[model samples]
Target: MKVTLRTDVLTNNNKAADFNRELFESTKTLVVNIMSSPGAGKTTLLEETVRALAKKYRIAVIEGDLATERDADRIRAMGARAVQINTHGGCHLDARMIAATLGELDLDEIDLLFIENVGNLVCPSGYDLGQHHKVAVLSVPEGNDKIPKYPQMFMRTELVLLNKIDLLPYLDFSVEEARKDLSEINPESTLFPLSARTQEGLHEWFSWIEGAYVRCVRQ
Candidate 1:
């Protein structure tokens, strides 16, 4: 019974995701779903991402957390339209939650939409939120073993942002080991080691986004 119920839930979620994809495609908006463990700098990365690209593109964000509208507020402070989805006790953001917020956002007026999923390595991996891309954030502080350990998350995401590289010198985290592990798990995926605070190696991420946007909207 439990298995059937869970499958049913996922089926319904997929339906909602299809709806969201159609809407996003119709509006020519590029939507990215960002996932990571709590404190992996998903919000800070987004904050900086918005800061860098806002002038060139019409950016919007959908911040998902178990509680608090803080992330959404932070994005709004940066002069972009943001919607906060409080999932209460839910571990991840579902398609229905995103579908509900679509009405609140003017999709035609937006060029990019970043959905910051509730920070969890496990729960967020299983849900489809109707995004054009799914990128995972893995911080240096989280250590090198995470990529191989959390295979589900790494397996599903095409890109991995290795945040907090600034702390690499002080900590025992290794970039080479991470690369090796990620290669073993998902060789097709690219890992960008960057620090949201110092903005190191961020331009590559921005360029990737530029390419993604062009592919999504123009091509």
Candidate 2:
């Protein structure tokens, strides 16, 4: 059965949008939606990012998974505010789901908001969650061929992170090929190649986030 939301619920989507926008504006938080396929190192990257910037900035995370508070717990263990959104059987997190969680967080105390969308290459790109930026994470093990197969996701990202570069030597992935493919799909998106585990090339990623936060604050 193809389940569908009611007309009233669809109509109320704007309310969610408005609420999210207002929350962001009032808090001046730089909300970043970090998206990618499962096992692409979204959580690992976020953990590294938080560790790198926590002393300099206040960070909060909203973790989305089909089921399990695991990701949220991980973030909380790091001393950051985190909330988990279990989608049950849903593949993605919509604006309304995000809007409903605003009350649970003290956004004013947060400088950055990282929403780790459910691990999927598709579906998540279709909706906007009132975020300032969308970062797409692609690991070397996933192959450089993903850009062509998932053009929509690539096209929508503001930044493309080529993660797990430390494994590049062990894998057959080509950095040049990945860059070329991404350029063909989205010539303007900024690309950062790094390994979240060993923290190689992480300085660039952290710098980008800091720059973005400054820009957001200035605006």
Candidate 3:
């Protein structure tokens, strides 16, 4: 079924933008929306990233899942303020959902806010949650063809994380192919290939994120 986005939805989305701008202006937090397919290591990356940067920067996470507090619990365990938004069968998180959760977070103490969107490629790409950047993750096991198949997801993302590179030797995936495809769709996006599980190639990821955080805070 084709879903036609109505004008009201667009208007509401604009309101969401305004809310996000106001919240960021008041709190001075850089919001990042992490998006990807299920089991693409969104939460795992968040855990690693939080562990690396939390001491230097105040970071919080709002995890969106279909129906569980599991991801949120994991984030909270790392000593960061975490909130879960259960979509209740919805494939994506809308702006109002995020707006509702704003009061629950202590924005004053946060320098970065990472919203892990529901595990889907299509729906989440269409919604604007007032984020400063959209970081998209593509696991190696998911194959190199995913870039062309889901061009919108890649095209809109500011950073593309080619995760699960540790499995490349076992799979038929080609890093070059993935890079080529991504270049075709989004030539300017910074791509990071790493393993969230083994921590391989994580330093570059950490550096990129830290640099981005510093830049955002400075602005």
Task: Give the best candidate by lDDT.
Answer: 1
lDDT of 3 by residue, 1-219 (tens): 998866665788769877986787678788899999999999999999898888888989999999989999999988889999999999998888999999998888899899999999999998889888898999999998888999999999988898999899899998888888898999998788899899998899888877877777777
Q: Is candidate 1 or candidate 3 better by TM-score?
A: 1
Against the unseen true structure, what C-alpha lDDT does each candidate score? 0.95, 0.90, 0.89
Off by over 4 Å in 2: 1-15
Among all candidates shown, the one with the greatest TM-score: 1
Candidate 3 regions with alpha-carbon error over 4 angstroms: 1-9
Reference-based TM-score, model 3: 0.94
lDDT of 3 at 130: 88
Q: In candidate 1, which residue ranges exceed 4 Å CA deviation?
A: 1-9
Best-first order by TM-score: 1, 3, 2
Task: Supply candidate 3's per-residue lDDT for 118.
Answer: 97
What TM-score goes with each of the models?
Answer: 0.96, 0.93, 0.94
Residue 89 miss distance in model 1 (angstroms)? 0.7
User: lDDT at 82 for candidate 3?
Assistant: 96
Give the C-alpha lDDT of model 1: 0.95
